[model samples]
Target: LDWSFRTTTRAAQKLPENVEEILTEAALREAHLIRKYDIPAALRVNTDQTQTVYQQGTNTTWNKKGDRQVPAVGIDEKRAFTLVPSISASGELLPFQAIYHGATPASCPDRKSPFYTEAEQLGFRLEPSKSDTYWSTMAMMKSLVDDVIAPYFECKKNELGIEDPDNQYSIWKIDCWSVHKSKEFLSWMRTTHPKILVIFVPGNCT
Candidate 1:
């Protein structure tokens, strides 16, 4: 199986051209199949309690520093890269898996993700808290793969001399969103690529 951590900017810059390249060139060159997909990042929200009081001798007052649920935007841009290379073993090409890591919740602060520490270490400034934007990025990547990369592969298949009719390929773009409210995206994915698998990863409570 092909496994990868979430995407990071640094990681994306270092990956090969396509998923196929990594599978063929990596040590797992003998494997018959490979699996690759983006892992949704974790998210966190502030939960504070508030109290209101009323008294005959004192003025009424209300406190509003209560709980908040914010979506995190972590690791989304860090692992976006293409892979497209295979090596020769025993003079025969083999099936391979390629993956491009996408975003994660750990990268966002409002989401209380952990990736902010790394981003700071890397000299990147954190952005202000905002609405969860992970799914938007996922959709964008899906469009890129569908509109650009897939067609390129079709064109190159003949020139590259690829002859395996059983060879299968897939693309996975991931993001974090509320399961209760993200039905729209879910529906879109189901209608567009019903065969693809979708996995959701939640954030740590602490």
Candidate 2:
């Protein structure tokens, strides 16, 4: 077996008390929600976001002697994409969404491309965010709730013979971020998705 040592970033090295509280609350909330709603594991869902970069870094590479830089074939190393995925406690998966930086991809065919519509058919949504280093914003979160979360909640409720609107509930977990703290986002969650409760993980924990 081979092993190597690596250094983690400041965020990875730190584990604050707030993180503990968030974990505790998450567990308690899940238990309470299940008991109160009589929810099956299949109906309880959680979601998180992750980013994928197009570049790979290597410490060792074969090259001509004293070559200034080795030739590498890859897409823009600095470019990245964020993916949001949801899965139920029972392992049921919801359609995933991807966020890109620009209004349209450089590879897009035309100004009136049906790429987005095509993606929708394949159970994925590809969209652009406001910033180049795109993090999920209030608008994006709202769209996520409306187009993905709400629909999934309804589908699960129907499948489990729980149609009493009032009785159907969904538990969605997300990290604590500024975009998620918007008044509009909170109000939308409360009113538009009354049955779907969004839980925030502790700040700096995720």
Candidate 3:
């Protein structure tokens, strides 16, 4: 028997039985909704948040083939922040929000800093989480909608000559995170902005 040493690879997270079915169903449903509403690509938006570390020195290690143990480093400092980016189906990049994790507002960059000024000029927000985790809270989600999503939609509605913002139908795609899927969040969205339809991408489907 001959075996060659190789780098270990990350294992698949999900082994669902019907992955094809799941994805096909999701696509079909989304298409149906878009077609039914005749929503333009400008108003259809998809957004996602990702955590990034200040130092990403090492992500891989030499390992034998078929081994699951892959020791890695560069994350011991545990300093990280969450960045949310959004884009429309028409290829319009929307303003995103950056959430800094800290116990207080002091976590935010100095107002006088160039980074702060650049962020402001670019229409992006750099806000503190006011908590231990960079994960979005109900309040943070609200801010995201009010500051980034709502404004973008409003501009698009105006450009489309839609007089009633309340009647401007659109779709928003987000992951099924706990904060986004909570009853309170859904209720708030329905009550405050019924025109914006929220859809959750099935977790771990890709």
Q: Per-residue lDDT for 55-173 in model 1, tens only? A: 21222233455636433434122322232222222232222112223254344344345765554543332321123332223444344335443433344444455454124333232
- Which digits, one per residue and each the tens of the lDDT, describe model 2 over residues 12-85? 55778677777788789778877887777866777788886657444455689988987765523666777899
* TM-score of model 2 (CA atoms): 0.77
Clashing pairs in 3: none
lDDT of 3: 0.85
TM-scores, all candidates, are 0.24, 0.77, 0.85
Per-residue CA lDDT of candidate 3, range 155-188, in tens? Answer: 8988988767667689999998899999999999
Model-by-model lDDT, in order?
0.33, 0.73, 0.85
lDDT of 3 at 144: 95
Error of 1 at 87 (Å): 19
Q: Give the TM-score of candidate 1.
A: 0.24
**Lowest-lDDT window of 10 residues in candidate 2?**
103-112
* Higher-scoring candidate on lDDT, 1 or 3: 3
